[model samples]
Target: MAVGSVALAGTVSGGEFANPHLCQKGQQLLLYFRTIYGKQILAGYNVYPHTPDDYQQTGRHAAIWGRDIQWLGDVDEVIAHVQRHGYILTLHWHWFFGGDSAWTRERKTPVVLDQLLKPGTPEHDTLMRELSKTADVLEKLQQAGIVVLWRPLHEIDGGWFWWTDLQHPENTAELWRVMFRYFTEERKLNNLIWVYSAGVGDLKKKPPEWRRRFYPGDQYVDIAGIDIYGVDLQQDETPYWDYFRAMEEICPGKTLALCECDAIPNPDKMVAGKTPCWLYALPWWGCPHPRRSVDWARFTMGHPQVITLDELPLFDDASYAPELGILRPADDGGAWFPNSVPVIEGFVAGRGSPVDLLQFLVDDKVVAEIRHPPRDFSWTWPGDLHGTFELTARAYDAAGKQNLSNRIHIAVGVRNAARSRSVRASSGTNPEAAVDGSYYSGWHAAKDAEDAWIEVDLGSPVEISQVNLIWGWKIHPAKFAVEISRSAPDDSERSWETVSLLEDLPWQPWKATHRVRFAPRIARAVRVHAYQRAAHQTWAGYDLAEIEIPIPAR
Candidate 1:
């Protein structure tokens, strides 16, 4: 196959299969994920809950529920219930053989791929028996007219599974092909939608090259997926977006899915065009990870963009599908100073389709056409242009199918006066570090102090509209007041005017950036007065990684 020659699933309708050439389906079923479902993401969960209605705490059932086939006694009952309720069904198998679990052999004594494929060998026999058993269950589902999103040999390159061998991608691909043929041709199980899932490799590595190594080809896959767990969605979603783009290039016309996840990403962010559109997400079952809670689940399930079980449509709806979202400048928009070049970024979804041209538009005019791989989804504006303008993007595939991004309005000539400015704090310890433009260093207040304050001198009176406080690692002030003064900071008799009184800051135990925007004001000095520290904070005083003051115009 050519690098990006395959036609994408952009034109396929929701709930329908893709053309057989794209995969085994007649029409792209998950094309809707990047189109209609782009605005309505399918939320799912793994395994059943202890209590029948435990997940109802989110006020609704997920659109799909996945399970390890080994845990169920009667797969038919579960299949019937899922199908009867109009919910999607997904299943996986953790093969146990020779007293070793699926994850027990890869590192120590891995299953040799070649031996497993050689029919007469013991390894081959073991695989055939397991495949037969799994096929029998799938055959039952097929007989019952139930469609399954089946994930077998998941995370093939993760090195945790018995079949994994990063150096021999061809072997992994062959293993998948063998299973694909056994289940589809021999067993004649047509109800399964094959999902090829990759593992989230080293947390620090965000490139997609490693994932592409394990791909078994488009003919053997209906959906390309990745398993995400333990990563805090509250922090940054860049890694997920990066992989989302990676998978699209790896399998140009396959539906992209989150086979397994820990935290359910915020749908609001998706609606705001901050992340890629996934076909569906199945969060691991049971106790919520610390990053996720019932409240968060409720928020995700209840959001209009997040489609729960009841929200799924009865029939296929294709109309038009395209998922191009502007992830930079934010959906809320941004303001930059004149002569400041801003980076524009976006996400393209829908069967991990390849983008031929990602054109950055300003007020409907093409500013730049990003032709290279959107590794970071980043494109720097060529010139330092200033003024309020509407921003949007258009991504065209090889077939010229267009995916339009969400539009945002941004203004230039907004300067950050606090950058490299004279800053001081009550602690009198390296106060300048807070405005040093480095998140690595911060200023901490006096130990066990009842109060703390950090002030910045803007050099000259500038109209400041926003103040961004980058909280230090796990430390933030619960209550703080932003005060401005027209007089010099050293003046003992200078009067300070309270501009904004912020309180009850949420406990987001991470280095998070919080923004406070107020009516534009001209002030020579701005200071933050901290009262109570955030809950569970072990530090004695308020700490800040960096502070930014954006003046709408000088």
Candidate 2:
């Protein structure tokens, strides 16, 4: 089938899936991919059996895809299972029959691409039957109001698949075109958003050649996706950036995605690196090993940029204005101090109409309202509120329609005392490290040091209500005292007084934070004296990750 012959009449405009709304003029798949852009990214999970019902049970991903459908009964059943949830569905086909019969030892060499493409050949007939079965399922889904992010012949640039070992790279492209024609023209499956995906490893092994060789052309693809693994997921390594940029240069106008990842990328690193173009990421599932921990999952999914399954909108609602989406004091990362005013911020992506007003809600009650809100809106909470609270924002369009944003869970308490403070140690140590705003880096005292002392300069005389200390590995203090002083440590007129004393502090295998609240004291400097060191398996000196002091409201 000629690629040009396929009519574009029923092709779903990629723009329809862009933005927070169903159908608005914006970047394609931006709603699902870059919902938080610079600040957050969307989280997705792939499950075994690939059924929508099973995915719903996990309650993790905003988008779901499946592989190994044969193991889950039938392809149509899997499609039906996924269609029920109306999720952003992606499908992966592991073509084991390419050449080596790894699944079965019966076939060693798969038929050549030329033979498979030729009419009246046994290989051609066999391949057609398989394609017809998939197309049949997709046709049913199309009739049922489902659009699939269909990724067939994936990882074809890698040598592991039969399709990848074709005599020439053009042969693989031909195979892709054949499959595209069969699904779109022969079977009339317009609900598919064709994705041209390749493995990052193959791109590295083959370099620039692999991208050009395997590409099926812009006319045949809507999104360019890459499968990445076996690297540090915590950092945005060079390989990922290379492939991301290559896809943009190679495909030019198509959207980009992380088709399959063994380790989810760190949200902070992704944002810091400025590669927010990733529309969505689907991490391969099989816990406690290649998959990330529950903490990592929670952090990524709860980020502002990431849209989980529960957060995604119904396909039918894409044409309307999206419900308000919270932008600040992130759901999981946000914290408020007791007796301190906390500001809540969010925005509604108005679909064609202007937003008339925005109402900020605390525990379902309207706390603040803004008329004719700007592109973004914010409201400050009453300072007296304490304990845990839930926050949400609602927006009203010009027509008076209302929509609510996601809920943010926050705790009102004494803020971190050590943040944004200058520190000095009595004896030589990396005192400044403790206040650097990172858990991995901390202040370390001299080896076997005893009676170690660290002092913090608040830069001004402020009322302090609490002191929080975070201990590093095998370096907790057994006894400590918090002291306050009005003058510099070296000043002859300086007066120091103990404000809080802690004894017999417990040790933890992992770093832990200990909070101590005291009667509010006004001072310019605070000191922590370690009277004794806990029995250490390694070093006996003190090590502190952070020192937090919360100032009470006036």
Candidate 3:
């Protein structure tokens, strides 16, 4: 399925839809994001009713220019929302020249199309001014240090959007050049990076002249991109790869991006890391409207790569895990980014100090919470802990008192260790802060025995989708695997349950990265072990550079 020939999904047998927007993915770009999009991207509304359905079918994720984009009342609502809750606002500009087709089918009312398509009129100038007004917003946001991946009039070669039928490819290209040159080159807006896109199916089919016409010129473009929403790709074996091959041939050396993509999942399986410079990836908004599912919360947090506008910063943070109740909190001065709350479990160690803890997200929202020390028996939070200087206990079942644990409410501030502690993922850089004084433990080593491996405290049982194993001699036959047991960190004799393994790579100064995904299984702690041998003796040592923990579906 090399993409020279792509079968249309909704077409009849022997009939092919050959317009070039069909998606055959090449490399899965890891994008990280959140579920919220608001005022920051208000300009996207210029495209009109920029509905989620439009996003799926047309590849327009809201960069519009119109007076109606913002609510008349209080614009601060969106501004405060992002500041307090860590919601992301994506900036996108889409083409609107075509009369609309299948994806837009009967949805973009004719009235809307008329307004968008009517170029060179007073009304259009006013529209342009309105869009330009969003510049004020972008400038202000830049001062605030918010990053925007500004994509304007994307995928020109497809001939479906506004660039259609424009005289002289240079004229359309000039339009693009003027936009950024005026905004950045002249205006000195350095924070904005351009994403140049095209969805024209096969590069071979394009005559040199036509392909040349599609480009807005390389000077203004920063990132090469494409948009693909497949209807029947899941039915095929290699749906996305072939689609990417088409773009790869067209763009040649430039990195191809999923400008506005959600055609498939498990992009990590397709594109592993930054080696080939797959660079930045941000998927379309989480189903833009009520059509968005709650599961999007999981999708936003679980995938190591994919991110919504809301969770964009998490990719740079590298530690936020939404599953364990930790979330990417908006930057709180010097506080560790991406907080977590206590993730409750059905069981806890009785007659023991609580090893569990709480962490927050980037938004500083309560992601999870753990009742640090068990109440010496099975107990639940019967009421809010607003202690009146003493502890209270109540029994659930007096008839079976032996089986029931009494409810206990005690003042917690003096014992809340989290007040002075930091929530973070385990790493070599954090050896002192590595263990939370928790009971769980396992070992992970780096290049050798002295490489210093620390057992990650899982805090609680969780299913992990993928684990990153890095740093080992590629030529070495050393095989690495993780072992899990109910064993405490101090004890090495506890029974171990081996789960995942890592294959050694050609050890370079920068280790070749590998992503290992498996069915989600709950484990409290994992030990990474690498098997190696020497002449006349056999030895096992572990080496790692970076590790990415992806959570699978529950």
Candidate 4:
């Protein structure tokens, strides 16, 4: 339940805003944008369910409920806030039932839509009960005068969720139809404006018939939308535009939208071309958060054609067209911006390539070149390399044309197991597992062990430059200290010095590799001491996928 701010109000009944009775208020709002598509676009922002009310101060025209709203206990409060703010509410459901049954407790295993769609099964009954409960909540909101843009089972072209099955299109299509019928007809929830959304990949790969394969039908859908991210926005947007064309062919006259995007589309670029007919755009909630820049919001919100909350007409106003004016055609043909540079996607581990390559480079200098390279290859650096380096790849065809890939910047220290003679953990299964150079295997402290340590013997005194630690699947030390010990050969004198102290490390379910570089020092042994585990860890112990200690090549 993410939120955004606006400064306007409106009232309306079904279809008046769009087809005058065929569509609901929410649908009308979408159609209103369609009517003015080429001339104007609407700016929307998502709100987290728990985000403070002041979050609405951003002056966005529309508000989206974050994916987590499906599981939240305070949905009523979220709806009330949207109504109070006079925002056109849109809801995205990231159903968690597919992953964990413990969260819902209605089933013994994860919910499978294919099985649940079949009647008379326990799974089907449980899912229906759960969905009915949600419908009951939305029914109350409708009774209270809230019309929602309901986007469920979104991104069905992606395989990330149970509701999506790109390979089994028929199954996903049936699942969608079942849900739509159950909600619209069986439950009698008419206040919702159904939005049919597919991942950008669906639009890109599927043939023209792909639209028909997953479409529930125009009667069940009011808007055709897609979710896009900016990670590769600059590289290509053909699929984005293709979606608009597909929707026009499949559900002509229905409004098209950028339902979810990490970055807002450039207004000038979007409106310039035979504009792709995007009626509105809703950027995901975190775009303007600490990690992302507010430039996206600033640009879209300031665009002349973008409708902000303050500029929106009352929903029931019949004279809104006079205020908005007619759509205008583009002055010039749109320019296509495509990346001319070679695109690259691959990663290197330590100092080597994980896949075969025609050429490997470090800092734009070709270091290795292979003819008839294998599917995978590795190249050793000048072992003494201890700082950051940029790596790139180049492949050549028989015609001698060169194709370059994106550059990957990586530090060249922390080689695991090479210098480590023996490793010992204070208390754990397979103490030496951390140095085994396998992500699947790791050193695990005893179940009850809170504070733990893993010491590595380098066999002899060496100049240690950096230490890298990879966290395992379950547990990660939130607070830890890396220490170095320099001891005399006779074992008579020893001194331990803290080399690095890390606190408040974030916990992640997947393995994350972190490297810590320090001033070169001479030490016989190095140790990592864990002070605490991240809160999400199921066990009170320390776990590490791998430990690396790289000594400078002398």
- Top candidate on TM-score is 1
Q: Tens digits of per-residue lDDT for model 4 on 363-430?
A: 68887676654323444445444544445566543434344543333444423332235888889788
Question: For residues 180-203, what per-residue lDDT tens digits would candidate 1 score against the true structure?
Answer: 888877777777777889887763
TM-score of each: 0.52, 0.51, 0.39, 0.51
lDDT of 2 by residue, 333-407 (tens): 225455556676654544434678888777788877888887556677766676455667777778665667765
Off by over 4 Å in 4: 1-24, 27-31, 49-68, 98-114, 202-204, 231-239, 289-292, 316-554
**Stretches of candidate 2 exceeding 4 Å from the true structure:** 1-40, 49-59, 68-80, 96-107, 202-204, 274-276, 317-554
State the weakest 10-residue window (summed lDDT) of model 2.
Answer: 1-10
- lDDT to native, each model: 0.67, 0.63, 0.37, 0.59
Pick the lDDT winner. 1
Q: Which stretches of candidate 3 lie over 4 Å from their true place?
A: 1-75, 85-89, 94-131, 200-212, 231-239, 249-252, 271-301, 304-554
Q: Residue 146 lDDT in model 3?
A: 44
